[model samples]
Target: MRWFEIALVVLTLLSGLVWLLDKLFLAQRRAAHAGLLDDGRDPWYVDYAKAFFPVLAIVLVLRSFVAEPFRIPSNSMMPTLLTGDFILVNKFAYGLRLPISNAKIVPIGEPERGDVVVFKPPQHPEQDWIKRVIGLPGDTIEYKGNQVFVNGQPFGYERVGDYVGVGSGAEMTGASLLTERIPGRPHQVLEVDRLPFVDQGERGAQVVPAGHYFVMGDNRDRSDDSRFWGFLPEQNIRGKAFLVWLNCDSITNLCKHNFDTSRIGNRIP
Candidate 1:
């Protein structure tokens, strides 16, 4: 269950082997040895493959080119995304790519500001992290006083209110909420007032170079993101997160139990 994508790929690859064996040996040998090829009907192996080949191929294509499902596992995305939210990422929104290798075969578009994206961690490519795209290639990103400035322009922000957690986030209930606008993209950000803002300024303002990006989580105080590791390369981008099909972490007394029904069908900004 952990490596669902890997399992899918393995199943798909196995189907190819089954298909090959049925064609090279079973198809020809069954007629001579079993005399079933004269029945004018398909053999058992052929029938079995006929049922599974298309299904496996479709899974491979959709997961690689069209879309993919991912589960939120941490509080990094917090208010915007909870621990049990099952999200659908648009694979082709950024471009089409081959799975595992993740090599882009077509260039459709690139990351834009405020996009909630799923990308391989900069520190560990094997691990995937979901965060808001803060800076694009060649964009200067500066963080000071919990405010973000992109390309020397301070993005506008308005304090919304204190955040209240209903489920698992009950302990962090009184966090600050701010509506942030990053040029073209605008979204809500949560900050824990109890935590110092010093961490954001711990490292000097960073200049994002070409082909690289800066991303951060909504839970600014708790997330282990670009501030901790570094910038993410364009190739590591998986896709943009669009919808949350299900969210169930709160019922089990989990850490992210803030059940915000308003966020259920909310489109990613």
Candidate 2:
């Protein structure tokens, strides 16, 4: 996807440059000559540039600022988001940003605890990972007994039942499912049986530095997030992942399609 982003920007720029140069320079030259030795036909490259420039530019702007689509390749967000789920991320939810660099150009909002976000992890900036915000800047966060504590107040959790994963998430079956309350929203998190006690001691209660956040996956035990890689830097955020638009799992593969239409349009909690 990063490669796709780079390709999109490069194609858009190349096409737009060709079209602009033709309109401002080559076109005028062709008109001035009229029939001198020319048949008044634009070059093939210019024709291609003129045809593709607008479409490429429109897609680039929309994807860079309005919204963008992403496919979940792992079960890190299982139950909330399944592997093969296609989600639409709100690109300007936190702020407007440049396309490839992801540098914020305008301020709109900050990530609240519990917001699902897609970001470049500090340890692996080339990959995009999604997780729920657990701690804001200056707040202390901890994970113990399969529950999250923020600022010394543990988040409310109610056991739902045993989880039953499907498709790519089948490995998570038999995990304990519970609803956790944070940032005024209630969302489910999974606690696997293999994990015993998760007492991080001093590391669990670490304070989130300014411009950084603590994030964790809904699949609590399986995710490698802030608990493993450290706090998420504000600059690494790509956008808020707010919606799951499609789910195309292995059930839909092997030359046959079995997309789960029911998961479509579900808002990420």
Candidate 3:
């Protein structure tokens, strides 16, 4: 489990313990000594715990099962999600998992193609990454000349224009912008010059294994994704990104009103 998750669990347990002890034992003791000098006073730790228990419990529930906020640290999802974008992920969109353990106990819905998801990479389990789902279990995925194919059907792409990056993402300027139609959804993707159909350590086509997914970055040439590593295990999935709540450029530009107002309330595609 992550450090933040451990902290939440600890806080919740401590607060609950204090509350239970006070209700079952401490309260009776205090009542019996009503006229004593210390009757009206309670221990500092108990007071603090009682005051914080409700608030902590609420936060734990919300963050563990309702939703959680995450900050974008890389441009792998450029054109769809930019760096520094603070996004909210729907925790229960796929299912409900136990806090800390992350063991799914309730069945909700499964991820679909074209859904933008946040997950722990199979190779780097300690880090969290976000990408767009390209292929589901039992489906064959392929990439050739900057084009994507799912189960032998090529996804349609229409060249829109040259993409001009902004803020921290300016390094990707001049990439070709195209509208990629993935069945029901059409989203923009950036592609640099076409490299080989299969680069070193990258596969041209492969069948997605059960309980796994094939994902890729919108910035076709820049992302280190399943193309380079491997499939994303379903158990490692955190949640589906649904909206951008805030955005700010890097620290170097923090003083120039770096807040991106236009992207603040944008919905994640």
Q: Per-residue lDDT for 21-124 in model 1, tens only? A: 87788777766766544675676667767788789889889888988888788877877877767788999988898788788999999888888999898577
Sorted on lDDT, best first, the list reads 2, 3, 1
TM-score of 3: 0.94
Residue-wise C-alpha lDDT for candidate 3, range 4-112, written one tens digit per residue = 8889889989999999999999989878878856548778888999899999999999999999998899988999999989999999999999876678999799999
In model 2, which runs have C-alpha deviations exceeding 4 angstroms?
A: 194-202, 251-255
TM-score list, all predictions: 0.87, 0.94, 0.94
Cα displacement (Å) at residue 239, model 2: 0.2
Clashes of each: 2, 1, 0
Model 3 stretches with alpha carbons more than 4 Å out: 194-202, 251-256
Please tell me which model should have the higher lDDT, number 1 or number 3: 3
| Of 1 and 3, the candidate ranking higher by TM-score | 3
Residue-level lDDT of model 2, residues 56-160, one tens digit each, is 999999999999999888988878999988899999989999988999999999999889999999888899999989889999888776778888998888899
Alpha carbon lDDT of residue 225, candidate 2? Answer: 84
| Model 1 alpha-carbon miss at residue 226, Å | 1.3
